[model samples]
Target: MNRNAMTYRLFPAVFLLASAVATAAGTATVTQPEKLREQPGSSSWSIMELHRRTTVRVLETRRDWVQVEADGNRRGWVREQSLSMDAPTQNAFASPTRQPVGTDLPPVPRTAPRASNHALLLSLGSAAPASRQDATHAAAIARLMGVPDANIRQPAQAELTLDGLRKALVDLDARMGDRDRAFIHVSGNSTRLREAGRCSTGFTLPTSKDVLTATELAAHVRSLAHRADKLVLLIDTRAGAGACQASEDTVTHSLNEGKSRNILYLGATQEASTTPANSQGGLFTQALLACLDGRATLSAAAGMPTGRELVDCTRTTLANHPGARPLVTLAGNGNLIPAPVMPRGDAISPHALLTALHAQRDERRQISVNGLRTNYRAGGKPMRFTLTSSQPGYLHVVAASNDGFTLLYPNQIDPLGRIERTLTVTLPAQDNQTRPAPRASQSKATLLFLVTDGPRNFFRAGLSRAGAFAAAPADARTLRDLPLEILGGDNSPTCTRSETRNLGPSQLLLCSTSFGSALQEITETP
Candidate 1:
């Protein structure tokens, strides 16, 4: 054979070898908690749940899914988007020292310092009243999280042109030191475009082009990540088709390839979706702020809310609003405190209070409240619900709201909360269970059903009103006490041998005799 013909054959073999090597070169870190499915599609049974920052070996890929081998040799398929590849050159932007047009760069710190929290907020739709409100609320949250006033910045919406955005990022990048924590929140409009067979999204600014591409934004984020111990990026905008997916990929790659191992990317909507608005503002923002509001009340004893708590609370608050499914990527162990824990206050949001209760909930004894309507209209049919316990126990049902807490069960008409394993109790005694129409302001509430080994009174002695089903007021402090009060408080007659588990900053308690608790969220319609 001629020399050229032999060389051609060798080239093909070399190409195949290089391709295989490339496929096997790197590992992936879970950015989102996802189940490793026995098969690629969503319907397949899950082998196990892969949590954030769990490293896995990628064995092969199939379009949107990748087969991976996790710890203990457990292998299964997960969505490609749920994992971030370890790619060194995947960052979208240039070095932090590189100044963009119309920005003055500050002196970059040369050495690592003790990590501190910093924040930068931008509101692109300054002309809109709602956007302005969101921006103001976001700034308050940053401060509550312990970001110093000097370390936080919020550029005027009118000045947030493409150049203005770059200038702000450059300034934040310069202010950040190695091992510091940074938070960047952008509340604005968004534009999506497809060019050169690639889809990219951008924040619509006030400049001539009025759009800052996702690639550019991610690059700046990457630059900041290099100096940060942890970083959180919150994008609240009207996302178009491919908007969330493209930005998520870009930001995920930015963090994965950077020195920072702990990061969070929270987006307001899914691909091609728009978040719904409420009197407070966008539902997503309202949910987020509500969660933040509870930080002081709901956070662990030592400090602020963890990344996991915020993600969980935000998800729970927005669960009822299908149009606002947040795209969350929490990439770290659950120990990272996103903010400083605030002093306890009565202004605690219901969602935050729920988070604290949820942290202590254990369902081993199997108790539930059923037939409760998720949504009720004003002047609607009578509300009816049944409570069942797998083991014999005393039932205490408390309804929590922003206004206060109420002992909805065991009221005057019923008086008896004790139940048997073989029996089910229906509220209102089938006589006085009907409720007066709820007002517009009373649109939401959460019901906590606690089945304990012994009877417990959530309300004070002798504060009942005159009615068929007279109930006493239970304050926020009463509800916040939760399972601990149920298990270890002096009021529990038969409780004994209570133990506590310290998880990072939060300490949860367990009783020798297990109790069951369930929560139901109620929404009122007009």
Candidate 2:
């Protein structure tokens, strides 16, 4: 063959060799890992760090960062530079047809499980109003557990006759699969001892009428302790004479002997009795509801560092009755001081209280997923929802539940759409023994977004469908086709507006103009 022909044949072999070398060098692809950022120069703060590698599946990506799950099933964030687009494989240049890599990538993280649906027994003491408070608190707890609003039983009145209490328990048992624990509310004088069809002081010395006698209430509590998985007892009363002493003794005895998985007892006493104040009970109720909604441990919610508040409150209330333990007043430790009597019926508005409770409940539920972070993307569009606050100055987002109801939060959204910084939520498991056939219900989940310009805000039409535009001054008429709900107005005299629309079977869009223009969409599961 001629020299030129020979050279051409050799050139093909040389080119093939070069191509092989390039392929072996390994391709470098840009990947954005999930990360958590902290402020600079703070003892409690830490800077940006890689949480996971790019080879893992990217659940979602935004402008600044991406969320990924690692091979070991951990999820977190890393800077965009920390990730590379290298295809995960056992051998760098292995043939595509060959087994790609180490045991198939780990399973995706599952959303937190729903709380158990079971009957929640609530016991009320002498105060009829306290019953209502307990019911409200129970509703808040239910929300925290991801229980649908339709599943919660909020009695019309607090005071249930003995028959009513029994019937309520039975009905709740049927609805809740009979495995739920009971909540006992002991407050006020309505529970005073009764004789000859009239209210009167009982013979029991140094004990309050609101609480159970050491013998009677103890037996009932013990029975419940054995039958239920958890028991929450609350004592809301003034430390005074009569049945207060017995009530304390009964509760203390039960706590010492109870074997329930979780037991929470709270007590508050009046510092001084002047005219009855409604705010006192309301405040305690508010705090309790907040705690329950926040899903805070009992100790944190009661502000009881040593778990001795209940013991002390019981001791003081009982000491006033004859034949009771001596009132043991300990030195102050700079804890909360008892407040003087509040004005009678100086209670918070029910609407305001419900709104607040809903906000907290929403917040608690939003943080259910663990080990994730969030960042916004530049090109992504905004989603909007209405923002309403019973109390002004509170801006928050609401999340949907598995059952399709909106859960509101009291604060801003976290990196992973969680309401707060914390992760890990505890939920009660289904009690199969009592509920063989769980109730059949439809899922109608929606998220309610609330932005605040003042203490009390409304979901105005102008703010609707505001998610389509990022904080720009675009005319509303320009974006009429999108699903939006106008809320309030901009800093200018222009009317503020928010937008709301359904995203999918499990998601809702909420947009706001309050904090430098933001759009948030919350998703629910059924």
Candidate 3:
């Protein structure tokens, strides 16, 4: 609640400079895009981003953070380098009391004012059973943004319909009248907005017609979007195939009237993306949540995912599911999601986090989640095995099929514990598709491990000891739907040092390390 338009957009930019250069400089012009942050550090969240060549009058300065004013409310801190110190020469002699001949007033700084000061997003999930997964994902995203759990809307009501959805949106609109930078994620319907093809698979599967017809829903969304500075409408359902390919037309129509603000529209499939009522989440929603989970390398940094990267991550992660095609539409260049903020009283600072990250990378290299070759199994047995580790670390194991991820180690029998040297565990038997089983002679799985360096329970978010992941409808699942934060967080016990060599890919590397999924394998014992 003590949040401000904050970010250390200056952190990386200012890290290289000395204190002397941080003095209050003269008015300047922005030579490149500049992100205004609320605080003076690199890890702070960005409040507003100004484009290249924009001009501003310098107001004050702090270490590498320069406070500038382009207008009344457009005042914030940005890194000094983002602006050109050589502001357009202004006549020093010119004064309001007496102007010199041919005196030229400084041209108005080329700045586009923001629509609002703050943003309040609501992730509305369909109360229907089939749509619960979609709502679950929306809630996860809201959680990622550090949005309070109370503000996030879920399908808790006995009956869910279109009218209820509209009323909710209407109430939220009234509550958020022209607030700045408000971001919202509504997960209910899917559409390729251009063709007006909408499907409420998650909603209808529960055996109720959407209170609002497709047209009415679109109209309602447009009306609500009319007030926001940025809107990210996540469609959990996918529209039926109808000559219209999975495309970025979803928000084009709804947000056209309010195009001045930024909007990032995403849906699972232009063609109906499916989720069995029992699946962990809708096909597209699963990938979306994973990308936002701070693990996906959509960008060099894990601050948050951008609109463009969201499409790329979802497309590739969901590729194996040929039927579910996720699409994206970008209305403007802006980051709608706020970077994850650590809980207060947490000692982990931005500098400390950056240091920890570098240390973790080095540790990842030295350690190994080696699938040890046992004396009993000459070639290699996927079923009978002993999984060894080079050092003490937190490990999660999963097996992947073209179908989806099946949790292995963090199961009921072999829970996620601090392993010092090695762990003796078994892979699922062949033909047992649920756990890590060998398909080819060597099935692939990943050893998703992190060195505690003696630091444990990073997020302190407890790990799941359940025997299995939440069941997915035999179809439409993507990756394991478990508590991924078990991996770690800002305040999680930190890694002390890096090891010598990193573990390489295994013959049975099933999980995609690139996508941030988890898995660890052990050679089956004889």
Every model's Cα RMSD, please? Answer: 23.6, 28.2, 22.6
Q: lDDT, candidate 1, residue 398?
A: 69
Error of 3 at 170 (Å): 1.2
> How well does candidate 1 score on lDDT at residue 353?
57
Q: What is the descending TM-score order?
A: 1, 3, 2
Q: Give lDDT for model 1.
A: 0.56
Those runs of model 3 whose alpha carbons end farther than 4 Å from true positions after fitting are 1-130, 155-159, 180-207, 210-215, 241-250, 270-278, 300-304, 320-323, 327-526
Cα TM-score of candidate 2? 0.29
Which run of 10 residues does model 3 get worst, by summed lDDT?
492-501
Error of 1 at 282 (Å): 3.7
Misplaced by over 4 Å in model 1 are: 1-116, 195-197, 241-249, 257-259, 270-279, 295-304, 321-335, 342-526
TM-score of each: 0.40, 0.29, 0.36
**Residue 435, candidate 1: alpha-carbon lDDT:** 51
- Model 1 TM: 0.40
Off by over 4 Å in 2: 1-115, 118-134, 145-147, 170-218, 238-247, 259-261, 269-275, 279-282, 291-526
